[model samples]
Target: MTHTRRDVFLGLGAVGLLGACANGVGGRGGATIDARVDATLAQLYRDYPATRQLADKSAGLLVMPLVTEAGLGFGGGGGNGALRIGGATVDYYNMVKASGGLQIGVQQYSHVLFFMTDDALQTFRRSGGFAAGAGIAYATPQKGEALAAETTTSLAPVIAVIFGQSGLRVGATLEGVKYTRIIP
Candidate 1:
């Protein structure tokens, strides 16, 4: 058998798409997504008490309970989640990512975005797809310590907290995530 570079790329793309879909990107409607959101929030607040304040102050929240990513040279990932406004599920969203760089390995992680202003939440909801930007502040947790919302996070309209990572990936960063609203 002879496989060209294009053939390999096509095969990888198909496998990545299938892997994303199989992760239940929009599988069971809002129920499963909301459940995961609730559990994720509970765990987050319990583990990082400092984040509860951010949640309380934020106008909305987008919680992606689990996103699985894998790659040898190219990589992709997807996950289902819920957006909460006023602490209630207002919409469902799916996150997808793709990247090509010096990367390899598989990983799973949870991420939550706190929309600190109504304007920010509205902009995200109205967009066809929202991508995390430089303005977004990240509250990355460290070992044996609660992540505190920095002054920069308070100034930014959107704050992202990524935690509960389990994988063998060398470095993890949500640099190219594209989030879109989903019916499920």
Candidate 2:
């Protein structure tokens, strides 16, 4: 395909506009993020009651209230969240991701990471920026269905529950997502 400078600028401009539309970006502040986190958790527990058990068993939970993602050819996403231990907020974090491929869409979703083991929670807390890797297990539940927190998931150090997705995008995965602690 032939490339023009105009095409490049338009793509970049579109991405910038998408970033602005994302939730919890552009200095929304700690209180705003906390509110969203609480609401997200409430919705999660309501949708999948089984997750409450997981939350209780988890060493810590990182709740991302909303992540906004969009792409034409290249894409990126960002969101703010809170880390909770024993039902209390301990820290705030921001999640970000970037990708380039044959993709085009915009989507919004919420995800929570369950640190099943103290080691996993410590590893995440100690890191300057933590990226999701192979060690993490994903549990995506369909609407009105229970999360299958089986023996395998119990043994996994970290479990991720992704839900409340809405948009033109097809799927959501944390494969390349990175989490960093933020003051806000």
Candidate 3:
């Protein structure tokens, strides 16, 4: 068999596309998403009781039940989630990220963003897309550790808690996650 550079590139592209599909990328509807959101929140409350305080203090929450990320020097991730206001799912959202760095492996995790202020939640919904920025506070769950949301931390406009991690990926960072409201 003979192959050219173009063929090699095309082959890589196909593999990447297949990998994304294998991650279960589409066809999630309202009922399915809401069920997952409910389960995810229950698990979070069970696993990290301290997070309950964070949730209680927030005006809204964006719950991403599963985010699957895979990388081989270049990386990408996609996940579907629900945005809740006043304890009801007001909208659906999809998160996607792309990055290039010295990274390899695959991981799956869940994350929730707490909008502490009505303004923050309003801004997020009004924007076409929202990106996690430096001003946001992060509370990564750890085994046998209590996520203490001090008064100052709770006062932050946006708070993020990442937990329920599985797979071989070394680390997960939210630097490039971009959230877009979706019909699902």
Q: List runs of model 3 lying over 4 Å from the truth.
A: 1-28, 151-155, 171-175
Residue pairs that clash (backbone atoms under 3 angstroms), model 1: none
lDDT of 3 by residue, 68-126 (tens): 77765556777888999889999999888765445557778999999988999999999
> TM-score of every model?
0.86, 0.87, 0.84
lDDT of each: 0.79, 0.83, 0.79
TM-score of 1: 0.86
**What lDDT score goes with residue 53 in model 2?**
86
lDDT by residue (1-184, candidate 1, tens digit) is: 3445864585387446646465444457677778789999999998888888888888999999998877645667778898999888988888877755545677888999999889999999999999887778887786457666656356689999899999886544334889998886
Using TM-score, rank the candidates from best to worst: 2, 1, 3
CA shift at 93, candidate 2, in angstroms? 0.5
Model 3 gets an lDDT of 0.79
lDDT tens per residue, model 2, 7-105: 456547656876676455457687888899999999999999999988988899999998887765556788889999999999999888775555568
